[model samples]
Target: MTAVMAPSSSADDMPRPRLLERIGIPRALAWGFLGVLVFMVGDGVESGYLSPYLLEEGVSKERIALLFSVYGATASVAAWFSGALSDLWGPRRVMMLGLALWVVFQTVFLVFALPTVDFPLLLLGYGLRGFGYPLFAYGFLIWVTAVTPRRRLGSAVGWFWFAFTGGLPTLGSLLAGLAVPRAGAYATLWLALGLVVTGGAIALLLVREPTGRARLAPAGERPVATLLGSLAIIWRRPRVGTGALVRAINTTPQFGFLVFLPVFFTDTLGFALSEWLQLLSAMFATNIFFNLIFGVVGDRFGWQRTIAWFGGVGCAVTTLLLYYGTTAAGDNYALAMVLVSLFGATLAGYVPLSALLPSLAPDHKGQALSALNLGAGASTFLGPALVGLLLGPLGVRGVMWTFAVLYLASAVMTVFLRLPDSAATAAHPATDHPATGAPATDHPAA
Candidate 1:
């Protein structure tokens, strides 16, 4: 007797009418984006003026530098583990651990360390707090890759960055600017803490994607193996390591630029501190929008080509123009603004790398992203370190040239980051199942 076959139901067959999905967000992970935005805003509250504030409080320059160095180091390690741990424990649990760490350490920092100006306690509290946001933010990033379809992954990762940068120095600094005058830095920190808690609760409670609740790696995989795999993938997939280096180079110059560009604009070029700051804000504000634009561009224009040309090569040219053009323009604030804005837009071109790296090792995406995260964390330190080391001997121009060279090198490296034929096909899969001629689902099983 012949039996009639029933139609199979899958995520692809389900109608996607949600506004978030229409705008390229994975429907299930929408709340997580808002959570990241708010959480990063809390974390970034101190970024704009923390060093200056510490100095005013009598913390020595040496101690402030040391504190940030330690914090950056811890952040790097945590960034690596965010993906690795996400593979082992699930993104939600990792994010929760990060939130707990941030709350515990930040309280100790503000209440005890700041009150007494105890350097050791301050270091202990703040350094450890570094582990919080990377885990909280990048953990969500791993969740994005896990649940998002290959076709829309670029756009999804783009949204992840939009929320991330939007909260960070952008809104966070704005919030700090408004609050510090009225509430003072200490109280402002408490406000930041509150935002963090609210954001964490929102994400953890509201987002109910099942994949985030379960291990990303295959069942029975040992924890030790999972972590070691994160390291091993660097060598096993040399392209992943190359991509990490490219990623590091992508932002290293931004941090380095911060070190000396302010002096160049304010002192050398005769722009006011506020004007320099406005320029900085304008740059990143332009970047924030392009992050979303390039994500869609990457998906449509080909990730490799988009990253290589728009991100790598574009940055190389724009980096040079920002320095030399600004120098030539002298007090041409309008011209300077245009140059800096171009640099910022080019910077967003690298957003596609987030989507591309994970595609390299689909079965081991967590490890792949761990490598990417390591580059990101390293940039926080490497850029400033480069400036600290080179500013005296090389001067600003030489340093700008150095950053331009790095961009060119990244462009060269990115040319080799092409996906395999099968992987490329998977990334842009056909709508119908070839064998059965049935509708296929791009969404992976949660």
Candidate 2:
């Protein structure tokens, strides 16, 4: 009798393409990201001057900060469950709910709160609006992880940040600059509301539900773990915890730095509004390229080292150079722009983290990714609060130097991050650790 041979499964059997091919990210998914970009640009139109608008409307600066604090806090808490809910109920249903809630809150803010300049109503409306974007955006992130192949996960995540960073506070600011001058903040916000509804609808239409992953049963049973219980994976894994920390560290400087950097450049430094805007554009453009570049690098070189050196140490050095270089360069605006652009480019090192965190928790990606967003949301509140407290006493240079130290601390933290044994085993089957079980090779985070 002839001996029967079983079919062999091997990495060689799987084709790995050039990172530039963008294989892991499907085309329709990219379009959905573009829809997200549209929604953000509208929402972000206020990024440049919301405080000034509020102050002009007679609200105290302290009150405005409190409003923002509430918004950030609410968003952070919402983010904690958005991913888990996506995992449990499916991304499509949760995202639709988020969009509907955003429309309702935004309309209320524009109609009732804006007309009367109602502080309490503003708090309620904006606070509810906070729940809108993270669910839509992070829910899509979970969708991305589910559909993309493991090999191209980093590149896909890079594109996610590309949409995220490129739209908000960058493109959004540019659009705001134009609109606030001609249309006024009130009308401009209406335009933003329209975009949120339209873009979210487009995303819903374009993106499809994932079929491959296991989901919580629709009717027969509750999940084995409660929503809170599901998050235990994060505490159990060192890599996941480090990822959350790194995400918080990566974003903290941006919020804190932006809080003062714009005014300092235009007012204190005596640069023209147009000149400062141009410099910002250049810096963010550099950031966009590096986001994609580092994603590819992470795939070839290794994600952890890429984040530790490029993200942690690179951010530390570049941040210092940006602050001190501007101070030392003085009247040399061109040189200052160069240093700032370099700072933005170095931030790309953290882009790979979207991919790395999910890889660390194959069995609990929804929970892991939610933790990542939780840290990000917390940073938005914490970073600015820290800068606000220190700004009076420390001054710009001193406060900025403190920001550099935070980056260094993040770098130090990265040393403890290690890929989960399951991921390692998937990569090299012969080296399987006894602790690892089923291989989780695809998932998402932001």
Candidate 3:
């Protein structure tokens, strides 16, 4: 019997050739990401400040956490479905909806901030924001990957993270800190609402309306409905299963360890709100620098190696230093701040995931990306809660170990997730790891 290979998407599938064939950067893609950054600034305003804002309005911690949990739950549902929706509706339309939601969701809070509305309304408001966010991010990533080169996707994703996580959050927190105090909560809310709307308009221009829902159907797969069935066919492969595990496990440090670092400072170390924001500021700054640096590292050393060297082992050591170094009350704060910077810089394996992830299905970039995003979005909640449970018994120290283990798990799973480098000379014996000195012909992503 003659063997048949799954059809692979060629350079022709990319939107950039006609759009920016001459320019090295995809101007539209850059704009799309920038618009996302702007949208996220408004988003961070809510995440970094909204809980505290609610607290100041006299909400209890238990209630706030319950609200947080509800938002997380809604986001989880959105994550599971949004990518599939983008697949059906096209990334541009899905993203536009996300942007529209951000504008309206916050406005809902602004209008409903009255004391009489009660916590359920507040929960509903937060849930809407949460639902909108990952979908927006999902759309943004799809747009970025479609315009970018397959070979350079890792570095492109690095830039995406630099803007997505580093720049936007930094600005968002700053705006929230500066605006909320001076203008009061409603004023800050109005300003963010305007930003989201303006950002969406820019995105609409930047994203270029999708030519069709998701990737143009495989030659004979005329409708997207047929592509949806292919998703099930692809998921049965070992590659998708292993790839999703690599992505989900690797994301824990960022979603799990990083979130709690702030909580650790506030709850265990006793830092005031101002001090916490300042520390977060430092971490975000460092995150931007590392994002650019390690992205290059992934390009040079190979993404899997970077994950093992930086995201994996680096996470363990950096986290432990935070756990063990500070015995006295205030002593923990300075060391924790330093360690948090390290986490921002080194916990960057997630950036390479965009490249590593899409390559998993080789022939199905859309489904692969969706699968990975689904895993990652789900991890946002799972990672935090998994560690949160451990925190009660393990205390700070025990949680550190859990974080370390999670990073280690992320690293080990790399054994199963490999991306074949198209740039590699086909003539070279396929026996070497491109980025690492070590031989990794045996590894999945090698």
TM-score of each: 0.88, 0.85, 0.81
Candidate 1 per-residue C-alpha lDDT over 1-446 given as tens digits, one digit per residue, 9 for 90 to 100: 00011111222245644666667787778889999999988987776667667877998655665677677777778889998898888889999999999999999999999999999999999989988888999999988777666566788899999988877766776677778878988899999999999999999999877778867777787899989989888888898998999998998898666556766787799986556656776777788899999999998898888888999899999999998998888978899889988998999999999988876776567888999998887787677677767777898898999999999899999877998866666676645342211225322111
Query: Which wins on lDDT, candidate 1 or candidate 2?
Result: 1
Clashes of 3: 5
Give the number of colliding residue pairs in candidate 2: 1
Error of 2 at 259 (Å): 2.8
Could you tell which candidate, 2 or 3, scores higher by lDDT? Answer: 2
- The residue pairs that clash in candidate 1, if any, are none
In the predicted model 2, the residue pairs found to clash are: 145-443
**Regions of model 1 farther than 4 Å from truth:** 1-13, 58-63, 258-274, 327-333, 432-446
> What's the true lDDT of residue 244 in model 2?
83
Q: Each prediction's Cα lDDT score?
A: 0.80, 0.69, 0.61
lDDT of 1 at 63: 64
Off by over 4 Å in 3: 1-24, 209-235, 253-263, 326-334, 420-446
Of candidates 3 and 2, the better by TM-score: 2
Instruction: Between candidates 1 and 3, name the one with more favorable TM-score.
Output: 1
Residue 439 miss distance in model 2 (angstroms):
6.2
Query: Would you give me the overall lDDT of model 1?
Result: 0.80
